[model samples]
Target: MAVPGMMRAVEIKAPGGPEMLVETTVPVPVPGQGEVLIEVAAAGVNRPDVLQRQGRYPPPAGASPLPGLEVAGTIAAVGPGVDPGAVGRRVCSLVAGGGYAEYALADHAQCMPLPPGLAMEEAAALPETLMTVWHNLFERAYVASGDHVLIHGGTSGIGTMAISLCRLFGITSIVTCGSDGKCRAALDWGAGHAINYRDEDFVEAVKRITGGAGVDAVLDMVGGDYLPRNLQCLAEDGRHVSIAVLGGAKAEILIPQIMTRRLTLTGSTLRPRTSAFKALLVDEIMRTAWLFVAEGTLRPAMDRIFPLAQAADAHSRMEAGEHVGKIVLKVR
Candidate 1:
């Protein structure tokens, strides 16, 4: 297959709102050693992409400056050290950047083969949310079957994936959403309990739902004051994992409470990590979590698909806080 010299992509024109995302034609990137060129069919719109568009979360050093972080497509070309046979393979990849484009470059190790039954849009949604949920809920928090967890933003892509994964693994999940409608949606998505944060206190709700025992852990995205409240929702020897700080960065927590209860608090960002580490994580996923995905038992809760040129509208929908699940860009 011949690769094009130029391609259309969405670029952040200025550090501002969703309107800043503009489509432009630029020279298509060539794959470097250990990388592959992807003819993007679809790309997942995530909170990190929105942050990058706003100039809050910059891409890692030497990564593409474009906003998107995940993409699904066919491998158009392979670089040195990668098998030439990979050129025509279909995959969904966790890219560091450059996903909101007609063509994107991804590490060979980061690419996961797409199952025949999966749609490109659904495959695009898997890499980021699936890996994040698996690493945080199971690996970092050490949640297991029979464990109860409190998850924030239950209707978002990450939230829905967490809900489904927990349900599949026999872990009970209590999720918090902004409206009663979204709360109901979360419950229907297999969340054991859903609290409308706008109407009810999630900390109190978690306690009530768990019969005053508190949850085994909390998968929190809202930081700041929610940190202390999340701690309050934890049972003894519980874990709290923070993924995002959509609320505020700074927080005040009682040190004595952590000491007395032997609680654990930890978090991670996946973008800046080395490719070798990501490769190992991918290997682990292939052995465990990827089984369910391959079996067609786990599928992303898709919200809507926007054309690649309408990337700004996609971001606007995500920021509006009305979407129930994953929003994707149909680049093909």
Candidate 2:
């Protein structure tokens, strides 16, 4: 297993669009203490990557400024304090940045062994959405068995994973998608109900589906005008977790409703969190979600795979909003 001195990576030449992503050769990154160098087999293309490329989201300080957030690969080397034996293991990791290369470095604490039979591409899709869902739904909202939850963007990678994970844990999810086909896909992924936001109002649909009561929790990515509606769609003491501001960042919230309902509104961005925080999530996933993955109960929904050099094309597909699941790069 000879590691190359220089490797090809997709770099953002300037903040703009997909075309800004260019393939370039650079010296391979060296893993620091508690990190491992991964020979990337695949990298998951995420919305944050798109935002980063557009200059809307920048990598956190001390992080690799590359676009990719997650990767699945074999370890090429391990830094001090990490087990040397980890060098040859197949793993999927949640990285702060730097996954869009042939070789990338990840904190060992953020890495998890690949599930028994999952493919590298599928494994690559697990880290970002999985950790996001787990942190927001289970940890923050404290979603429990039999609780009803609402997930926005139900066909996106996070949406699909939330639906499946909700089902796995005995929670019911009502999801909103942009089309009839996407709605059907969400339902098939185990959502209790799917609302086509294009055809129907999600707040009304949630009320109807819940028998005039409302969901116990909501996983929201569309922040703007949907905020007040999300409030209306929640039961007393319910939780609303916002992960993204896809619609718009500014929102006029109804304070009275929040006060009357005793609701909890919170949100988090994953990249800026300390390594210790992510490590806690990794431990939890290994103990719970990993078992489901290993048993073939939880599977990553893959929409498309593109070659490493076609990174721009992959981003284009994601931006076009036709993809129903995770998009990945076959890095090899």
Q: Which tens-of-lDDT digit does each residue in 93-198 have in candidate 2?
A: 9999989999999999999998668999999999999999999999999999999999999999999999989999999999999999998898887888999998
TM-score of each: 0.99, 0.99
User: Which window of 10 residues has the lowest lDDT sum in candidate 1?
Assistant: 280-289
The per-model lDDT (C-alpha) reads 0.94, 0.94
lDDT score for residue 248 of model 2: 94
Query: Which parts of model 2 have CA positions greater than 4 angstroms off?
Result: none
